[model samples]
Target: MVQLLNSYISLVIERVTMTDEQLVKECVSGSQSAQKKFYDLFAKKMMGVCLRYTNNYEEAQDVLQDGFIKVFNKLPDFESKGSLEGWVRRIMVNTALDAYRKAKKYQKDVDVDSVGFMLDSKDFIVESINADDLLKIIRAIPEGYRVVFNMFAIEGYSHKEIAEQLGVTESTSKSQYSRAKKMLRKILIEKNFVEESERGH
Candidate 1:
């Protein structure tokens, strides 16, 4: 009877839907099951964020684990003023930046590439190269250019915010971003990954 009652209780508990707030509260209260649920909810998206900031799959996995540790430790202090996923995403981004800084990945001086922009970025977007190809090209760029491009163009961070996070001057951030775009444009064009169009634009 006791075992049957316990199983029944567990079944009832499992059927209950949890909002993010409730999941967070349960996690904060030391519920192992709740913590598992919390990790499952955000792990994939967080891993994508980690991958963008890392050079390869293994390093990205390392950053993902480190980011989750910080997330779990600091979660209790998470105020409810903003979306939980946004808060967690910010934590992951900061964790990646910290790892990058520890590895001394910051560039002291990156001159903008002088490649002329023969292709509009908008034109490249409509091509058939696919997302994985795009990611590969982004990863092939130098770390300084890659990081600035990811921050400013993809993450919607202003050059000023990227400058602060990267410990570079705003002009440096802008220069790197411009260099990343021009260099990426040149590579994609040379690779024939983009649609054929007149180059005079």
Candidate 2:
């Protein structure tokens, strides 16, 4: 899978614009050219989504290739409940979660109370960190925190959905998410993103 996706990445190809329905129809018809074009059109943005759910670039690429394969197989089944990109992203996120579940060791034994250091005030302006920078930071967090945080905070999945998906209790999901937020705040402060009041008072 990795080799296949790597080869796809190495090709110097430009993506062409096509209507979603037309592209989907061509891809579903098993047109190699259309499939390659579909991959080009969505891979970059979808890879970013994959990165947020994985720890590193290689794993992100793994999830990306896996997700794209699913998208191709499932294209004909899509009911257009939402935008094509959004549907693709939903699949990518679920595929990343599957990758996480396979690891089966994301449960952390950390002391969330001690680990939760501080909070960032509104003036902290975390927007200074762009998407890639933020993904790197989030990926550095513990696995449980990363999963819960990405699902609840970024993807806007409810605690119930997260608990069900991750095979944990809702409270566990909520606590891990809270801890993730606190940890993020601590990191941002250390990077000098704290408000003036947080600096000394």
Candidate 3:
């Protein structure tokens, strides 16, 4: 993947206007220029998704490279029933999940009950924090909590979906998400992004 990206990076390819379908058709037909164009189109936005799941930028880049490789290899299977970008984003997310599973031994899971830390009925009003700061705060969370948090909260996956994807119980997913929110709330208060009093108990 690294070598593939390096070759793309070395090329001084000229940009051309092509719709997603057109790009995919050319790419599937083995156009090197078209492949580079496809890579350039979605790499930045997908990198943001990758960053949300990874511990640091380098790991995110690695995920991004691997994701693109999968995207190309699986391009023939794309049905075009959805937007191409959406399809690519799913590949990137799933690629990240694969990385998370491979590193599972380093993470510890807490079999938290459904009753643990019910922040669902409460409200939090975070103030004046930019996207970068928020992303940093999320990246600081422990691996188990962070992955579950991103999948459930940000990606809009249900606890059942998360549990199935991560090979855990639905309750485990819920508990991890609750803990992630609790930790995030604590960071917001400590960093003065939200006042402790503003949070509902």
Candidate 4:
């Protein structure tokens, strides 16, 4: 009986929290209350999302604000066929990409025909690192590598897409992502955050 009552309470709480679709409908209708609630729901997550693509706090804040502006302006065109969160996420990503392009951050020319190199497999051992520590290490990566890494590894963009977006060759995108992974692994190893093979076992 106690377990059943607990489950019932959980369902009640879930029902009280508005779905993303419900929020979108309200936002599109220009409901101030809904807008406030939507901001409260996604602001922090969107900030973190922006931070991953930017070099510093100020740039991140700018991206976040700009992304939100785009979201509000484009909300009416959103088709409800898919996840509203996903639609908003794409906008945030494109906003970040636009910021990077406008900043002219990609300056290196890469030889696409160059041989592809492999990263050390040991880096995958970093499964033990906490989310916060992982984020810190990722943030420490240089801007070029950081952007590619976040897009490829976290945001699920392809090398071709990354290359096109950053105005670099596909080889450059792949190389930067590999370098980012190697650097992150090195940082984790130096911090003694990840156990050596024997210790990990």
Q: What is the lDDT, from 0 to 100, of the residue 120 in candidate 3?
A: 40
Which scores better on lDDT, 2 or 4? Answer: 2
Per-candidate local distance difference test: 0.82, 0.80, 0.81, 0.78
lDDT per residue (tens digit) for residues 112-199 in model 1:
4457754455754746778778778888888878888888777779999998888879998988887777778777877777634645
Give lDDT: candidate 2, residue 55: 75
Top candidate (lDDT):
1
Estimate, for each residue in 1-201, the C-alpha lDDT of model 4 and write its tens digit: 999999999997875786777788889899998898888778888888888888888998999899999999998888788977778888898999899888866746333223222335455446677766767788886777788988998788999999988878999898788767666655666787753442221
Location of the lowest summed lDDT over 10 successive residues in candidate 1: 117-126
Return whichever of 1 and 4 wins on TM-score: 1
Off by over 4 Å in 2: 1-17, 116-125, 196-201
Candidate 4, poorest ten consecutive residues by summed lDDT:
110-119
lDDT of 2: 0.80
Candidate 3 lDDT over 1-201, as tens digits, reads: 999987776663423446688789899999998998888889989999999999889999999999999999999988788999989998999999999889765344554343222334233334476778878988877888989888987787999999889988888787778888877777776787766776645
Model 1 residue 125 lDDT score: 72
The true-versus-predicted C-alpha distance at residue 87 of model 3, in Å, is 1.1
Give the per-residue Cα lDDT of candidate 1 at 99: 87
